[model samples]
Target: MVAEDDEINRMLTHHQLLDTGLVLEFAENGKVAVEKARANRYQLIMMDIQMPEMDGIYATKAIRLLPGYAEIPIIAMTANVFSQDRQVCLDAGINDHLPKPVRTEYLYDTLLKWLEK
Candidate 1:
């Protein structure tokens, strides 16, 4: 699952993930992201930190509370790279942080690191 509000980012990520052979699902905002999560099981979630309806942190927290989702990997995909922002994501139960303008190599690496688990 990829939760992102910006169309350009969404498209960019789509293209980036195209060759990975993963069936991707998209949510325009965190509320939709949570809804999708409740309805389906995804191996991993790439979540944007700043989104309308609900932010990634809250969505992650809400998803964490859902049955069967406690151990699911939810990674934050965001431009917020400050130490405190990273800490906030950690506190909210995000498994990892992927800084934005997401480089292809790091994206693959992060996916492998989490999905392999």
Candidate 2:
């Protein structure tokens, strides 16, 4: 699952994951992401920090409270790469941080790190 406000970022990820046979589900805002999460189980989630209705941090925290989602990996995909920003993401219950524009290698690596287990 992916929670992102930007169409380009969502499409880039869609293209990148096409070959992996992963079915992509998109949420344009944090509210939608939480709604979708309520209905399904995802192997992993890619979340954008900035979004409408609710921000990624809040959405992540909300998702963390859902049953069976506590151990799922939720990765932050954001332009903010500062140490403090990353710490904040971690503090919000995000499993990992991927700085944008996300390189193909790093994205795949992060997916593997969480999904391969």
Per-model TM against the reference: 0.98, 0.97
User: Which ten residues in a row are the worst by lDDT in model 1?
Assistant: 66-75
Angstrom error of the Cα, residue 29, model 2: value is 0.8
Worst 10 residues of 2 by lDDT: 15-24
Clashes of each: 0, 0
Candidate 2's residue-wise lDDT over 1-117, tens digit each? 999999999999898889998888999999999999999999899999999899999999999999999999999999999999999999999999999999999999999999987
| Residue 89 local lDDT, model 2 | 99
- Supply candidate 2's per-residue lDDT for 30: 94
Candidate 2: pairs in clash: none
- List pairs with backbone clashes in candidate 1: none
| lDDT string, candidate 1, 5-109, tens digits | 999999999999999998999999999999999999988999999999999999999999988999999999999999999999999999999999899999999
Best by the TM-score measure: 1
Off by over 4 Å in 2: none
